[model samples]
Target chain A: MTDAELLASCHTVFPGHKARTPAQMFAAMGAWCEEHGVAHDVYGSGALLQQFEQKIAALLGFESAVFCISGTMAQVTALRLACDDRASRLVALHPTSHILVHEKSNYQLLGHFDALQAGDRHRPWSVDDLAAIPDRLGAVAMEVPMREIGGQNPSWAELEAIKAHCRQRGAHLHMDGARLWEAAAGFKRTPRDVAAGFDSAYVSLYKGIGGLGGALLAGNGPFVARAAEWFRRQGGNVIHRSPYVVAAAMQFDQRLAAMPGYFARTEWLYGELRAHPLIKPNPAAPQANMLHLHLPVSRERALGIRNHLAAQHGIWLFSRASHAALEGTSVVEIYVGDNLLDMPDGAVREALTLFSSALAA
Target chain B: MTDAELLASCHTVFPGHKARTPAQMFAAMGAWCEEHGVAHDVYGSGALLQQFEQKIAALLGFESAVFCISGTMAQVTALRLACDDRASRLVALHPTSHILVHEKSNYQLLGHFDALQAGDRHRPWSVDDLAAIPDRLGAVAMEVPMREIGGQNPSWAELEAIKAHCRQRGAHLHMDGARLWEAAAGFKRTPRDVAAGFDSAYVSLYKGIGGLGGALLAGNGPFVARAAEWFRRQGGNVIHRSPYVVAAAMQFDQRLAAMPGYFARTEWLYGELRAHPLIKPNPAAPQANMLHLHLPVSRERALGIRNHLAAQHGIWLFSRASHAALEGTSVVEIYVGDNLLDMPDGAVREALTLFSSALAA
Candidate 1:
């Protein structure tokens, strides 16, 4: 069976949030709306969306927030607004930032801004990296708990230092906080506390909140108001966003409250996987509810093992394994969420043992 | 009460499609998915979205189609792709086109293309207008049944001549067919027939179909494949589009079939209003399911009459009135859809008489 088929047949997945069928998701949203006396939003405005945006703004300690259709829309617009009036339209970011690796250089292509790589790949950029930049920058974008590099986050003090350095350089600080919920748990701080220093921050509703899909870009009132205009320019302003807003609002509190538990589970899972000879956990420890496991197996073999785990044990470990920097090794990322919390430790331990045995063979 | 509160309290509305509450929309979508055994689409790929795209492509006689989150996204992407690889990145469009009036110049600001105004703002551009442009053009964007001009469309022969002119000039012809469904009914032709000769066309699902929100862009296979990449660039690709896809799909056939009825109703309504001295209908008659009513009243007076009609009769005529070129006059656009079909003609006539008496007073 194909990987998708295998994953579909599995009863449990040891990764991010549990998957919901469209029917279940819509049913839940319908029930929530009915219970809460929800009204539809028109052209991205109404009580429902406005209330949700306000709540998110309060949570992130920003004066206002705008809900976007996607994180790509939110982040690109935030960076564009940050850089709009500056003499130099250059934004600084890590080599592995989502804007660099995943977004097809939309920040440059569509937003008309040049991006300067601040640090090498495989790790988060530091305060020194920001200070070392020779050219003037309109903004500095930092991703908390960088996903491509095993969800590693900088220390709270380091983050504060980075903020201070950006201010000193007269560059706006923007957070690509798609996984800010996880990063907040890692920092042992509230989301508002962790989001305090950045001039603007974006959070994904779907990643940790398990919404169908949406994002929130939060900042000072005027900045966010400017982002709203950018939002219209990007066609992010749709007539009805109530479905996404309702879904995100319904799942937000419960999922956010579970983040610390998920983080603890990631720590335990990292410890368990570290002892295996074939498995090397990046970062040597867990910083959030995510880790990268570098396995000394061919990509085909890794797929086979993944399928075997699903078919025989009904445990989904990872979906895709990417080429690691090391020769003859593949890396798979695991994001701990409700799936890991719901599973007993013994089941995960047994699955790991079986996976290791299969790899050894 | 606020306009929105007035809209919400009304039992019947006479313009555009019937409105559904958030709870009703989600519940209907959920029930449809359950009945059809629907699976969620992941990041703009899946059988459901693909099938819908195929159906639209077939309907439009195009090789392929891509669903977008909004009409603005679809049109901008289409125009950008049409202009790419051309020596001249100058696009020709009517001065009052959505891209010019509503999109905040996204075509120029984000798409990086210069727009040359082709025709006067009060009417649809004809073949002569296309031939009059002095510069080498990358594309000519025509809005069928131009909404800003009371749903006016060029003749089929005029459209064909425009297409030929574009071909001779090596410029792509794009149709901003947001109301193409109604345009088809007005032309007494199939959508495929109306969509012919255009290199790319965009249609809105939420406008007449009563779907929550979405759009479709149709073109040749390669062009649409390129549009999918642009869709990603614009952050239009979301994790799950099943909600929108399903809603559009469920209503597609029913609403497409009802266009003729809506158009007929619009013709009748236009005749009823054209006889009134206090009201002048743009275009002098209806070409499609939309008409603009020019009333000899101030904006506040028009709005007060609208609110009074809603409060006393539960009949919604129009939401907002824009100042007309003539002094002490405002223009209100009325889109005939399911709501009008459901309302009795006597009630509508009575409301109009009351409105006329109110204006005379």
Candidate 2:
């Protein structure tokens, strides 16, 4: 197949119509390289990396930023750095946090750190729940919009209380701000405000930012500076990460500058899904661009429908095996991005209709 | 400036030039994707990843392989895996290994694994050096064709002795085989034969093979499978590493096949350099494609000559800050690649003449 064909295939496979054009990603990077008068050493420390880091720190109102290869590595490094002195290597967090479910004990294996399970997996972590945890905690990991249960977020008041509690206990509060932009939109707050209380925050460029690959860890001067060294040591350094960085900056430039508008689009998408009898969103109201949808179909059936929508109708959505409920209902994540925002609600509704028709067939 | 100018600027700064043209890397990957016809889900247990593991295992003469983002990560992960059952998380290694100098002690902070410094820093490890380590070692790390001091490799007999020593002591043998390809050429052996004694080996796609960015950790079936799980936990899984996989296959197809011919050119280059009076290679013998040429001049003067040659004559080479007894004498590493091999001996000699003229000027 040609490059165009490969690019189209990427679009088809990506769920929620959240894919960025490869051409656009590359073109922007190439342009950036020309402008900078330096090679886009995205992997190494260079102009592109510095600009991107500063842009992200400015966007999030952090003191500094360090780019890393992955959000997982970034979080692990940040948590390890946060464990700067006292006895406990224990990180307190909601049970459904990325550290617990996704990291697969890397904190334990590589960070030599343990997790203190603080919140219920089903609900967002509240101030009261955090307060109940014992003192002497090394760090508290908070996912801005909890991913496991469909991007639900607690109130700002509750977050402030939790932050104050951590400060009182001498605990470093870390924000797993993977989708902080989405949370900012939902909360009607700035990204900086949401990330304000945390000692460190990790934001992913690929998810809502629509880049090919990359993440950033932000914190105070010493913490971020050391994190940069750790990044090089971790082999997170790449030769031409400029492509990824440029892609991120391009998408983020367009999207992040207009994130306030994303809340309205998210609401529109969520409304249409809630009206459907077969579709069930976890929270009924989404706090971000992503939401988990439950369908009364088996995992295989859901995937079949997803394939049908992509291959037959050229509409992309997602289906997952693990998120499927035991009662024969499958849960799949649907993300809203630049592509989906332009496509009419009718296109998505029609895709779902096709999905149902395929299951019936 | 143009892309070529930017690339030239980068060429002037960093050391290695083993990378393949990005277009060639991408084209090779495109072919692999077509040949495999499998969706490369870089995240979890995907088909392409499964095939990647198996193919790498077959190539490295192991039962399985785990894919990671870079060689640095692959080495650190392998060491951590080896120490899983050990009472003391101590990894024994030569002082010149990548982990000690390049990685910034990630093994200490992340893996909680300490490097028990053994072996001479200037030369390859001996059997006596391996036996002298005082710790209850979890694993003994050895780099085939150690890159730091020059791509100098141990004789096959020394390797066999080191393997026997590790086996006798009931310690795991880990190979930091980032330059295993070069080592194999030097030893007149296949990659598999060279890396056979180690419990695990980490190989880089970008260094010698000229892929975009990726590494493979090959080992026994159980260990590799577990490593794959750790890979996921560490968030090394990007949304799509298929581009990298494609680049890797492309490198394997083009470079791996062309290695035999490349080695002949490298040998010829090594012979030519050794004939120089003022210039001297550390061992005065070329083991691999790369050799360090000690120039009888200050690093400042060496760099001045190097800049003059590159900016004026388009010749590229590397110099070290400190590497030998001739105190201000700089070490220039000559790497044989497609570009350098294409340069006529007359041009090569002229470049050296230009360097000498610059020093005189």
Candidate 3:
């Protein structure tokens, strides 16, 4: 058999033999520009990107939007702006929020924000968790379908209550909606429905949309006007964002439409896998397009089996299968993407059988 | 004359361009990639941008370097790193330094850097000027060839003394070398010679190099290592920077070679304009590729005459002919670029004759 034919039997994050390299992405953008006759957006001056921003803002039900290069910059700038008209610089976030854990508390370090941890790491915050904080808050930030913990999200009523509390406290509610697209599917609502409560929301352009790298902060006119200056000051204001804009706009429409299907597939996998004694899916339910698959092995053994499945069976799975806090068990987060749709109907069960057989061996 | 020919005959920032629109820039990058079989830089992953970075580091003689989306981010990150290893948060800068004046004190506001203004507005900082600051300083920032007043630089010996003074006071020396390429020609030295004494330096990619947008900060390995983390924290770290990388690399070689010529042309133009009674040149002697041309006209009148010349004589100057601190005299900063070189030999003399005669009337 040919090497290419042999590889076709295995599924990967990329399609068979077509890795999405930098040159490929750039070439795609160039092709996109020519096909659409897309005019270039010069140094944040083009109409195409502004239209992209408007489409996103409208989808999310925000009055205004400004694009960003990173979610860290977007969320940080949002929180800083929320605090601008307030006396308190104190902001509230979940303990496992990406900014608190990954970015070295840069909200306080670079953005001059004082962060207060609000929720438990194992679950999404409820109204009570936010109400327990004693002092006045400048802003309250919540990750929609928090990625670190099985992509769990609060119920609609619980979320609405938290938003109400923040408003009553004269604080802005900012959504760190990095995966808002998937989260909306879990809620069985349009993205606009999910974003209705927040004073400001930051949505990522890459994670769900698969753009180069960018995010957009959505808010009212005055809020975004204040935030744009900070965006410029932070050096996130690029001269030519057309490459990012074109790529993001092209994928945004396609992937956003497919999010519901990805979410359903994730739910189906979790349901099927939960019946096995050796296989455990966290939260006992799929909240979004992500699930934590717990294998009855150590983190190292789990990683080995994960790699083995890809190498031997050609059925690619998680790269980050890790040790669960529980003894003798490991976990991996499966974030469903468009690639998942390409797999055969029995792909998950078949993959699970191999995962279980390897651990047993 | 036809409108296109008439407009083309008058020089612009871009010779062939009515203006340098972003679409044209993007199309150029697309063409470059197709021509060179260039690869993409996915989240700073590709080697091509690093090759470009190495070229800059070697030219400036720094051990390590990192590219940033904006000079504002580069400088803020540099000063933050410089102060991290020390206790002092206070930084010394000229009163008119970009971070202070144009950015609206963002160094203090966004970066939390305390400002300690040093030196005179009219001239480059001397050893005496730096030695006069009493307090312990974390870092001292000087823009080589200060762009606002008139592109001016300290003599090599004077710069050395200022560097030594900063060293003796246990402060890091930071060079805001946004226009370092042109500044080197005025000093009659290499870029490495100019960057030798500073602990860290930043150079712009788009300003003189004609790239879309970006800047690079050069420093020692450890310093750059720390700054890189902040670069990510600040959201200046970009994925798919191939467009910027390709464009910047394409222009770097051509422009760096042409720096001396642009500087000389600026000096020549300044020398010719000084003889007129109503026309005046700031600093009396041209220092770099820029000078402030002062005329005995009000700001409003100067702007009207400036626009008239662009329309009538097919020679363009500036719209920022401002009311000088002195009454009745207006000043315009003339920043010489590649476009000026494209003008006819008699163009400057013709432009000057037109300018002086208008003021006289």
Q: DockQ of every model listed?
A: 0.77, 0.32, 0.42
Candidate 3 lDDT over residue span A1-361, tens digit each: 3332344455654221133544456657766776776765555766688898888888888889988877888888888878877978999989999888888667767756889998787889999998999988999988998888888888888988988888887888999999898899999999999999899998887777887678889999888878878887787777777767887887778788888888888877766776566877776788888877778888988867766666688876665667788787888777787676666767767777777778788
Question: Native contacts recovered, in order, as a fraction for each?
Answer: 0.75, 0.38, 0.54
Q: What is the lDDT of residue A233 in candidate 1?
A: 86
Q: Which parts of model 3 have CA positions greater than 4 angstroms off?
A: A1-11, A14-19, A30-46, A267-279, A306-315, A343-360, B1-20, B31-45, B239-243, B271-279, B298-315, B319-321, B327-329, B346-361
What tens-digit string does per-residue lDDT give for candidate 2 at A7-93? Answer: 355344324434433333333444554454434363565666788898888777788997777888788778777876546787887
Per-residue lDDT of candidate 3, residues B227-253 (tens digit) = 888888887766666667776887689
lDDT of 1 at A87: 67
Q: How many residue-pair clashes does candidate 2 contain?
A: 3
First chain TM-score, candidate 2:
0.89
| Winning model by DockQ | 1
Q: What CA root-mean-square deviation does each model show from the true structure?
A: 1.5, 4.4, 4.3
Better DockQ candidate (1, 2): 1
Model 3 Cα RMSD, 1 decimal: 4.3
Model 2 TM-score?
0.87
Q: Is candidate 1 or candidate 2 better by lDDT?
A: 1
Taking the tens digit of each residue's C-alpha lDDT, what string does model 1 give over A8-41? 8987788877888888888888888999989889
Answer with 1 or 3, whichever has the higher DockQ: 1
> How well does candidate 3 reproduce the true complex, by DockQ?
0.42
lDDT of 3 at A84: 70
